[model samples]
Target chain A: MRCFRFWPALAVISLAACTTAFPQAPNYGNLGRTPSKEEIQAWNQAIGPQGKELPPGSGTAKQGQEIFANKCAACHGPAGEGSQLAPRLVGGRGALNIPTPSRTLANYWPFATTIWDYINRAMPPKQEGSLSASDIYALTAFILYRNDIIPEGQVIDATSLPKVKMPNRDGFIPQRLEDIHDLRARGCGAGHCP
Target chain B: MSSKRSLRRQFLKNGAALAGFAAGAISSPAGKLFAADAPSADLHAYGQRSHFENDVRIGSLAMWPIVPGARRDYGFRSPLQDSMGIITPAPLHFIISHGHEPPDIDPREHRLMIHGMVDRPLIFTLDEIKRLPAVSRLHFLECHGNSAAAGPTGEPRKALAATVQDTHGLTSCSVWTGVPLALLLGQVGVQKGANWIVAEGSETGKHSKSIPLEKALDDCLVVYGQNGEALRPEQGYPLRLLVPGWQGINNVKWLRRIYVVDQPYMAMMESTKYPSARLDGKSRWFESEMGPKSVITRPSGGQQLGARGFYEITGLAWSGGGAVRRVEVSADGGRTWKDAQLQQPIAPKAHTRFGLAWTWNGEEAVLESRCTDDQGHVQPTLAGLNKFWGIDADYYRLPPATADMGNFNAIQPWRVSRDGSVSNALL
Candidate 1:
């Protein structure tokens, strides 16, 4: 009986020792590993509004015209007028106020960085993310020129792309929490909230 | 003992007699089997129906705009007119993609990386993510541009099926299970001053969108389970970011990465595609939450009532703000409405079933349903919503003169003719 009682006390002490062994360890469910820098660089290709992550490259509209005809015209059409598969990238200037606004890059886009970012990630739809940095800059320059946003001979690079002012730069009103709360309250009643 | 017959011989005689009796019973007229009705082909081991079940999804006979050599555009309309309850069958759920076929992704190779502006950047394989603490909730995923065809002129086609398909088919609801995004964010430890999180897909288009960090941490989920099963391929298979009660586009499918950032990415979709222009000439971006809406499914359109008698008018009602408090059904259009019986278990931000017993007279009548949510928001009529948005004569003359198809929650009207033909009401 004495031996049995001693064994129970010994087991309790061991359990306490086990608990104290890992006192300050943070539990992340011990799942998933930290990614390497190379892995991060390969996937972290998105460009923001301020051109923070833009790669170093430069291209002129003249260089971009050839690339556009060879790789993009099949979908975007000649002169970026658009085709059945893709949308028009140029023209439609001052059409936002018309009865049927043709929202092209010239009339609708607010930021030039978005144009470069979109093309870099999603252009040539089938073979996306396949364009070289210089090719992307050239395409961006060509599109901006076609939209009449930049001068004909101006070259576009990481620095100049963010400087180009778009037609609808001030068009959007960022939605606020109050707007959503109010919309829920009034439910878009007649002559009420919008 | 008296006859001295062997026990084995007696057993054989009894077995033969039993077999004969069973054959006689099976051959009786009452128990006759219609062998001809059985399919000639063998039934599948898992499950399959006979070829005679011709109830298939409707497909466009020909392409529109005729983009030669372009990706095939596949559009399937859910048979809403024939839907039975709140849960749409997985196969019949409506599909609206970017015309390109859904990329075939192997779940084993998929990885969800959380990086940028975080204390500890982490990449979780599909298996590792599934091992985290999970939650299940019912939510409705609606394309913000779902009812774009419900313009002032109405659908050009006279068929009621066309109206249902075009107006309300883009929305669907399901019970989803996944790890709360906040759980993952806490694990990575978001850095200070981070305002937005960009969710990117692995599709050919590399579709991506920027979402407010507040919204991402609130109730967003890294979902992999749908309707108690693995996520469907069309629905972002191995992983998808489910922004509950938000526009479908924000719920990026085939999710591959999450980037915690200091500013909105100004992606193509958010900048140009989803924003809607207002009467003031300024566009409204990030109209994320779906508005309160309701639709009459049964007796809605196309289906004709054989005899006008006691009929139960039933449909679906939901609101992004919260639970639906009440649903009112009107037999004479908006002139009058009676509160319908709301089905039980009315979950928040989910479809609520409602029904009303109506006695249909032989005279022509207009049927409609209006829903009010817990947030005191009542569903609006088309005219009411149009006026509320201030789309005046001049506004119509401007670009996007069509009805505010985006976020349109107008009361749907179903006109029942005297001859039992039901069609979409012009009102």
Candidate 2:
């Protein structure tokens, strides 16, 4: 049961030796093969705010409406108008300032690329990662058009997706480490704060 | 000749009676049953209580369907009122998932890819990772959205219909065994300016979250073992990320890939789901670490006491910041407090058990517990927590629905009736 034990003296000696000696990379003999480029590409699918990793695909709002009805309408509701199952995607515009803020994609999402990234990676609940790149773009475009953020005929692709400005783009503030420290000082009893 | 015949007859009669008794015993119902069929005094190789033992986890009836017609995605709270000690049994641990059951993974086929923002991107198989230096530590993992039922009034009375599990059941402590993430990062050689690492799961939903590099390097573990055995399927069978002291979501289960990056990916979960509004009219994202909190597990809500004279009040207390230093129990609803005895070996970022002996006079009394961590952070009252969040007197009518989801560690009170029935205190 006692599988681990401490060796303080040996650990200290090793640490001193490491600092005194000229540092060199310790090779751990290769145990696994390097992954192929295709394998790497398949797993590295996260698209950030800049949309730099968006794959080559294009779709229009009209095409997205059909795909949405077939794939997403069951959970997200028809026309993305909200349902008891999933969140509302279209409305909630200018609702963040109200007492009961309805934080929908149209109102609260800071980056449109997030929409594409999330859909591409996880969506349609029952069948995730089943949609093609073009289908994801179309769904993104349809949601944008329904929210009144984009025109009806606009085509959404890698280039246009990142440019779509969301209403609550400025809603979030960077987390401050100092604020946590201050809270700890006030919340933690006097003289015991971290 | 007469004497010999009498003796032979007597012997024959005795033998006949013995044979009939033996036949009847073998034909009886109890003799026909096997060892497994009924309770026995003998021991088993792997211990399992008889079916007659009624100590079981009571599922909460308040669980609602997640996707309308789908009951598979439903959540079950832990029965806190029925829990006994610091560590929760794996079966009784609270479960919350995003609309899918935990995926079963084969260890042989599993691989953990450490790529992006690293000098030497590498993929590690389950066997290869296990061969590396290992560490075992006890830590408590709690969901960021835990204890939503306990509102600002300090009274979770509505949750009485449900067990304590419904109110504050989404937390558990266990001994985790894994290779330190820092060692893996060192092997991969993290590149400069990499501030974030996105940990992704292989679940059907591809549940993912962005973790700060500082945390990833500090005490994070790519864990594969829990409570001294291979993890349960529900707890991510083959592998999981153990972000000690952080919220449960950050500890991604079924861990498959880790992408080192210069900035947080701001995934849907992190951006839209985890962040909560603050009193300053701003939102705080990645409120990862849990605050100091404690709950009176015994005599908590639904349990009834029979002729209470001398009773022991005990519960579990934990803090994400550090080891719990002291726990205070109040028998008269915070009007008076007494220091409770903290159990030995209080591990950092682990649940510590505390107990106090009290003499009940069979009168109505309110019991509560407050814990303070080594870092000096004390558990806050419900009203104090509401005030910290800038909620006003009309909080019940217009609750801060969005802001108060995370970091909800309010003092829980239990009302003991003179008639020996214990219930949630409506403070």
Error (Å) of candidate 1 at residue B377 is 0.8
Chain B TM-score by candidate, in order shown: 0.82, 0.83
Residue-by-residue lDDT tens digits, candidate 1, A1-194: 33335566666556555445533333666698899999998898788887878888999888999999999988778878876667778786755543345566888888899988888887776688789989989989999888778887998998988888888887766443223323334343321334
Candidate 2 C-alpha lDDT tens digits along B1-427: 1123323322332332233222111111011112234655456655555554323332222212243322222244555665556777776666655555678788999999998898888999999988887899989888766665323212332444323554566778888999899888887889998888889988877877888898899899999998888887778779999988877888888999999987777788887866666544455566677888898877666555656577888888998888999999999999999999998769998989899998888899898999899988889887787667666545545543443446678888888788655666633
Quality of model 2 by C-alpha lDDT = 0.71
Candidate 1 docking quality: incorrect, acceptable, medium or high? acceptable
Worst 10 residues of 1 chain B by lDDT: B23-32
Number of clashing pairs, model 1?
Answer: 0
Candidate 2 per-residue lDDT, tens place, A18-80, comes to 543424434556854567778878998888776877889999899999999998888688878
Q: For residues B226-289, could you state the per-residue lDDT of candidate 1 as single tens digits?
A: 8888887877887899987777778888899999998878898877876765656566666677
